[model samples]
Target: MTPRLALADMAATVSSEDLSNLQLLLKAPSKDAVRDVCLQSHRAPSRRLAEATAATLGVPVSQAAELVRSLHVLSHHVLFYNLSSPEQILALFPESFHSSLKNLITKILLENSPTWRTEAVSDQISLPQLKDLDWRVDMVTGSDSVSRMSVPTCLVQLQMEDPCPTAGGESVSTVTVELSRESLDTILDGLGRIRDQLSVVAGK
Candidate 1:
């Protein structure tokens, strides 16, 4: 499936050390062990899960915990990238990882993808969102021909809603920000870079 997340550029963010830890971790846990650890990650506290994982994998608690963390980081990155199938995961991770490690990573990500997607949706719905955006252009014109010149500016008003607001607080907030031509051009340039990055990631 195509990726749903805007991809906070996870491919660049995940480190070589993280992948190495995950590779080592794959050799330690059986498929069933990995399934249980993934389930426990959603339910248990960090320390408890680490201890349980340590005992299950017969590794030191710190090492086990680190492995679990690495697994999670990689899993989320996989999910965010929407690399659902083994082929897609391999495509993204090939050369760096061997076949077996890639297979296991794919399996773990598949097992956890559904729940992660649900949680991501719920998280997004709970946050503030922009309801409407209104904007206008204004010009400053000098009075006489001797001083006749025009400067233009844009004013933007945003209507935002907090789906879950603090007690006794307003659910909707109005904010206005001003953007000069230069600042607007800078913002547009930044947006262009982001668009190009997405296109590259999507193989467009």
Candidate 2:
């Protein structure tokens, strides 16, 4: 059997070291598939193997996150492991990854190296955000009754105090939201849609 099939068949039963080795040997595209098989086949997936596999691959940040999420090994160290370039790391990873290390010793790392992407350790070393946040107001829409605004990210909730009240005398309009984990592709697609919408609005 090819490395892929062998991994799929034995990924669940394989030891953590062997599983991680198998993942590194297989092609990048096949890694997620093997991960799925292992998840379904095992009651509890191996965090050690999952973290190892994630550190080896160089796909988008969203795909790397899914592996950690599936294995329930969400951590600052595991997600950012073996990556390069602080600029690239900050761009690729989600905001949650940033928030995770915000309170830790990342401030010290920033002071020392200024850019340390690969040496992300939870207890001893923390990755800091040295770059400035560039937040652009993508869209703004409002009505006499209620207001609405959207950014480049998905249709997430943005809370603010409204001055006006609804017909029901409710000052706040509660929007029912069902949240799910978004992939890198999903975010990029959302941004593309926002860009097209902006173009149409501007008569371009």
Candidate 3:
């Protein structure tokens, strides 16, 4: 199965903690909680929510800075929504977080597409980690780029980049990623942990 399909399967089996954390992170009003969510979300991007959380909790700007740093560390492995097509990825996240989802989709498309040498000289190639989502784009000359884009729950845009370029004076041939329900579940589980952590911060 494709990674996205696997993720969908895993998302189906989310635990109470995952659901609770997700809700709390999205709705809570604590700066620390917001920061925790941001960090856990894998730097997935929730600008509006982050700002609101910071304001509600009266968190100092310096503390917010530190929180952002912590979030970076947490997000390293988090599956950003932008790693696939926006329409497909948004379907996976809760509808309430559509804004965040859109941002995630954009991020993946713009930032995550891979770059590599193409068959044509002076040509480059890139592919986003769209996983199981069906997508088609007209091939272009010079640089052939494909991306797996997504919209994250945090209303952030994200895209994974994987490029396959031809030898010389050619175009990128193909690019793909394996997907499975189990793997997607694991990724969601990790994201849930971040949600839980954010809830804790919000409690304070």
Candidate 4:
């Protein structure tokens, strides 16, 4: 029951003052909203602005930063379709914004990812506030690092340093993510019918 679509839902709640800002943030070639807030206040990179924004949004400053970051990804089709992960979505939102949806979101990520084959995470996190797990995912890929949310502090991460791709003879490089044995077992009865599971999730 987590916020099904973070951007759509949040966009609706944005106040009139920030409505234009939200438009700019969501517009093509997304701009940094939080940074804009900082510049407008004549305090670039000030922690206070983040804190203030976080307070207003009822989220952590870190999550606020994530919202700005996601805007960039959502604007760019490549990044949005390729790297946007469930962890990133969950991070930019508080627990109240989402119910027990991390598991569902994790599965959705696996279904949509082109990289999970390379990135695998097996870290133990403990967060009571988070309905799912207490973790913070800071993905360190081949080079580009992106996205964040309140989703407790425990992160569900998928890190891939460098995965040699087998796409044709072009020597493509890609970073993929995968849930560990422990995490999968928590939600799945068995991996034998993963396709079937995905079908259910995809509404097929």
Candidate 5:
């Protein structure tokens, strides 16, 4: 049978027993390492194998999807977050790719934050603003091709207190910054240029 057909059949016939087998296969080591066992069983397509394997292991598809996406986010963090220079980060992609990359990063950051659900306080902060200044990213990866390419997004919230006094004589203020990949790049670039210019002046 064709690999795709074989995969379809495996998906259709998946059972507790199949799941058990897959679990055992996964236990051996990494997902790639278990490929031989999966291939020998029926030579299913990788996508089919992932679904079937996930089913067997009792992992819900949604949870599996999230896990897969997380890995992508992690990759971006590793690749760009620690760069020693703005030029270095910019060099990773062509100028044309920058806009899309920034957009993706922004969307990922926004999607991950729980504050997105909160109503904006006009005089205080909006969801995007909160996201801007304080958020954390988490990543996950899985065995499927889709999961490999998927970006899992989530946010860690930061707490801020208002120091301005309100009518009740209590401090009242809110702040947030919704950060996207593009916004982050813009912010970074501004800071870098300022530093560089400062250095040039100081040397004169």
Candidate 6:
């Protein structure tokens, strides 16, 4: 419950009004109903769901909607911190919360924790993976005057797999870099040093 944990910090974000609504929403007779609203909030808000929840809690629809939003954000915070235990989840509540209110919050988080965790993991942005590397050497033979100037250049292309690419769209992207001989040699030297370091590590 220390401020070091983000859940504790997020717990401080709840206003007194929202906290009151949350307490009422959790104290509803049917725990399943409360859990359903919390889970739906994770996806998207629905007016029908809010209205129904409002009726169940005998509060205004606005209050019910706000409760759902608070629960949604709270659940996300819980997932972010990967807090699994009821005690850890309960840390989001004020110390003044009675045992029943604390128990309800813990129950809601524990019941939906697995699904929330799975969604969180799946929502992570994947880093692009290197798929292929291509290089070509070209000789630049002259400029406008044709003074017999010759310079070698290397073109390198890096192809990477696009993680979480759009549906039915290209999943690969290429980056090209042109390097003069001097720059190319510097790159080769760096690569050589990396290879040597890797060899040393492998030997060890």
- Per-residue lDDT of model 1, residues 1-204, tens digit only: 454754343343456776676554554557777677765653323887788788887878887777767666666677666666777766656486877756766776777787777766555546689999999997756546543357677888999999878889999999998788899899889999999999999995
Residues 1-204, model 6: lDDT tens digits: 322233333333445555566776655778777667777776666888779778878889988888877776677667666678987877767777666766877787788878766665555567889999999988778667465257677899999998778889788999999898889889999999999999999999
Q: What lDDT score belongs to each candidate, Candidate 1 first?
A: 0.70, 0.37, 0.40, 0.38, 0.39, 0.74
Off by over 4 Å in 2: 1-156, 160-165, 174-178, 183-188, 200-203
**Candidates 1 and 6, the one with greater TM-score:** 6
What digit string (tens of lDDT, one per residue) describes model 2 on residues 1-204? Answer: 111221222223213433233232233445345444333323234455455455556544444445444333212222334223345334433453434332221222233222322222222322232222222223435435343333233334433334444456744444423232354467668989999999999994
Candidate 4 lDDT at 34 equals 33
- Considering every candidate listed, which one attains the maximal TM-score? 6
lDDT of 3 by residue, 1-204 (tens): 222222322123323333233333343454445544453434234555456545654665444444443333223312322234445534435655447533543344334322201112122234445333343332233323333233112212233334553345333224443333465577779989999999999999
Each model's total of backbone clashes? 0, 0, 56, 13, 21, 0
Residue pairs in candidate 2 whose N, alpha carbon or C atoms collide under 3 angstroms: none
TM-score of 2: 0.17
Give candidate 1 misplaced runs (Cα > 4 Å): 1-12, 24-29, 42-45, 92-98, 125-162, 167-204
Considering TM-score, which of the candidate structures 1 and 4 is the better prediction for this target?
Answer: 1
> What would the TM-scores of all predictions be?
0.52, 0.17, 0.22, 0.17, 0.21, 0.68
Q: Which candidate's lDDT is highest?
A: 6
Residue 203, candidate 3: C-alpha displacement in angstroms: 60
* Residue-level lDDT for 114 in candidate 6: 83
Q: Which model, 1 or 3, shows the larger TM-score? A: 1
Candidate 4 weakest ten by summed lDDT: 117-126
Query: What is the total number of backbone clashes in candidate 4?
Result: 13
User: Cα deviation of 107 in candidate 3 (Å)?
Assistant: 4.8
TM-score of 5: 0.21
Give the clashing pairs for model 6.
Answer: none
Cand. 4 TM to true fold:
0.17
